[model samples]
Structure formats: structure tokens, C-alpha cells
Target: MNPARAPQSVPARLAQIALYGVAAAAVAGLVALIVSAVLNGSLTRSGTADALGWGALILGFLSGAVAYSQSGQSRIESTMRARLGEGYRAPGLPWPQILAPLIGAGILSAIVFALN
Candidate 1:
């Protein structure tokens, strides 16, 4: 070992997150394809109900998060930032802003993931 060896670079915990995110997304997509194929047969009605239930659970939690809002420009921002990372200003009317992104994304997801 050299006495003048360069210092080692510290690893960021988030570095593997993006790769895993992509991989998980790909896996989810493939599973969705399989589920639709199954839904076309015996699981059709029940599967649709399950999907709607999942949507409701997800949307309700998301709405609650929005309602909670951020502590905005406060002392706890550092704590919140550590937990959720940075926040950005969303430019739009409150109601429409709340509804639009989720709805648009849902619509696009549904179209791409149409069962029939």
C-alpha cells in the first residue's frame, strides 16, 4: 500500500435507487401484462374490483398527503427535506392542480394498460 494513496470516494445510498427503480418498473410492466392476460379469463370481474381498490387506496393516501401540505419555509424544513428531499412550487389552480396530474397520469396508465 502506498503512503500517498488517494482517499476513497464515499458511496451515496441513492445511487442504486435509480437502477432498481427502472428494474422494478420493468418488472411491474411485465406482471401487468400477465395479469391482463389472466383477467381476460376467469379472474375478469374480481380483478377489476381489485384494481379499483388499489387505486382508491393509493389516491386516498396521496390526497391526504396533499392536504397535510408542507411545513414551508420553517425550521423543520431540514427534517422534512431529509425525509422527502426538496419541494418544488406547483404552478396552477389549487383544485385543478390537485386533480389534474393524478388524473392525467391515471388516464394515460389506463389507456396503456387497458384490459379490453
Candidate 2:
């Protein structure tokens, strides 16, 4: 298997992230549309808000899954490198992994409050 290469540059990393983000947003939008239709039989304000909250929840769940996957990969990589006599330092906590869910939850809460 190939090793995980570092990102080529900061801009490249950002662009990659941006692409994933756009895809996520598209998925969330589709979800919201379906939810709104089911919950209200049309896209009303309340339905839209509720659907958005659901979307936020979904995004948070997805973010957590991604974080877990990345953490597992890092652990495996670190272990393999250590076994090969390369120095292995403990990976620092990933801030994006930690923060994304919190932010999503906050958005969800705000939307819920606004709707009520």
C-alpha cells in the first residue's frame, strides 16, 4: 500500500478541503429538501428551519465519522513507522475534528431556537 503523502501546499490543502465542503453542502441541501417536503408537505419557513437543523445534525455526524477515520489512519501510520525504526511522536489532537461537531451543534441549536 502507498504511504499517506503530505499535502503538496497550503493552497492545495485548502482547495481539497473546499471541494469536500462543497460536496458536503450539496448533500446537506438535498437532505434538507427531502426533510422539508416530508415534514411540511411543502417548503415553509418552519419546515426549512427544521430541515436545516436536521442537516446540521447530519453534518456533525459526518464530521465525527471523518475525524474517527483520520484518527485511525494516523494511529496505523504512526505504528508502522515506529516498527520500521522511524521515530514516532504522538499525534496532537486534531482541532478540526474537535471543533466541527461543536459548531454544527451550535448551529442546530440556534436554528431550533429561532424556529420556536
Candidate 3:
């Protein structure tokens, strides 16, 4: 039962991942609103939705990429440590966390399309 093998506590992990998704969504939504306003010279419902959806999708994909890169980095570090006979422990990839933003993006996109 290596500590590194065990994933983080469920509730804590969920909260952290959820926060990340929500923050990303909010930031993306704001950016989209600004861009829509600038391009259209005013705010429109469809425009807002489209902008938010695009923002969320782009940021979500970026977040997933970053998570993947981090996972790869961890694995590499672990391998290096093992080869060096060091006692460094690398955390396992948190798949649920990594997928959270992507899931949020999909849901947001669906809602946007439905509205439009």
C-alpha cells in the first residue's frame, strides 16, 4: 500500500478538480464575453453563448494537455529516481481530475448548441 500508489482522498480530490473546472469556465466565459462585445460592438445572446463555448472548449483542452504533460513528467522523474536508486516517490496520474475540465467543456458546448 504505497502512499504514492493510492490516489488522493476522494472528497478532497473532487473539490480540487471541481474548483479548477469552475475557475477555468468562469475565466473563459469572461474572455468570451469581452471578445464578443469587441467584435460585435454590442452584446448578443447567441454571440455570448458562442464565445463562452469556444473559450471553455479551448481552455479545457489546454488544461487536459497540461495534465497529460504533468503525468508524463512524473513518470519520467520516477524512472530517473529508480535508476538512480533514490527514494523519490512520484504521484500517479489523477485521471478523474485530468478529465474534469474536458467534461465541463463538453457539457457547456452542448448547452450552447442547444440554446443556439
Candidate 4:
């Protein structure tokens, strides 16, 4: 049995693709939000608003990514456990680590948008 040629299971491949898709969605959503803010003039010419908007966009994306990652991991773990007839525990992302930064960025972006 060649380790390199080991057959990959469909469920594992699907789980991996789902994780990647979630990450791509998060990044795309962030970019879209930032672009929309800029186009709507919600960000000012001083660059401060732009920075704030970007910050918020990134924070929100991170938050969402962490959440989705954990959810996907849980689903994968559950499916694997069920198939293998064993208990599984998947580690979740550290959401608290990004919460404060996200809240601050959100507030800053709101203020900037309000002033614009």
C-alpha cells in the first residue's frame, strides 16, 4: 500500500472543499462590503473612514470565518464519528480573540459613515 497513492474518501474531500469555500466566501464578502462603502461615499477622502471601513470589513470577515470554520468542523467531525462509530471532538476557533477588535472596528466604521 503506497501512502502517497492512498485513496481519498469522498466525504473527506467534500469537507475540505467546504472549508475552502467558506474561507473564499468570507474574503469575497469583506471585499464587497469595503467596495460598496467606498462607492457609496460612506468612507471619506481623509482615509480615516476608509481605514475604519476596511478594519470593520476585515473584523467582520474574521468573525464570520471563525464561526463558519467551527461549524464546518463540527459537521465533519459528527459525520466521521457517526460513520466510524466513535466519539469525536473538533476544536473550535478562538472567537473571543477577535470580538473586541470587531466591535471597535464596527463602531468606528459607523461613526465614520455617519459623519460622511
**lDDT tens digits, residue span 75-115, model 2:** 99999999999988767666545455545555565766787
Between candidates 3 and 4, the lDDT winner:
3
Instruction: Rank by lDDT, highest first.
Output: 3, 2, 4, 1
Predictions ranked by TM-score, top down? 3, 2, 4, 1
1-116 per-residue lDDT for model 3 (tens digits): 99778888889887877777776667777887898899999987888787878887786777679787988899889889999999877886667666666656765677687778
Candidate 2 lDDT: 0.69
Clash pairs, candidate 4, are none
Top candidate by lDDT: 3
lDDT of 4 at 96: 50
lDDT of 1 at 100: 33
Task: Give a tens-digit lDDT track for model 1, residues 18-48.
Answer: 3443443344444544665576764464465
User: Highest TM-score, which number?
Assistant: 3
Q: In model 2, which residue pairs have backbone atoms overlapping below 3 Å?
A: none
- Model 2 C-alpha RMSD to native: 6.2
Which residue pairs collide, candidate 3? none
Per-residue alpha-carbon lDDT of candidate 4 for residues 20-95, written as tens digits (9 for 90 to 100): 5454444543564577667776744555555556656676777677788788888988898889999777766654
RMSD of 1: 11.6
Each model's total of backbone clashes? 0, 0, 0, 0
- On the 0 to 100 scale, the lDDT of residue 61 in model 2 is 80
Better of 1 and 2 by TM-score: 2
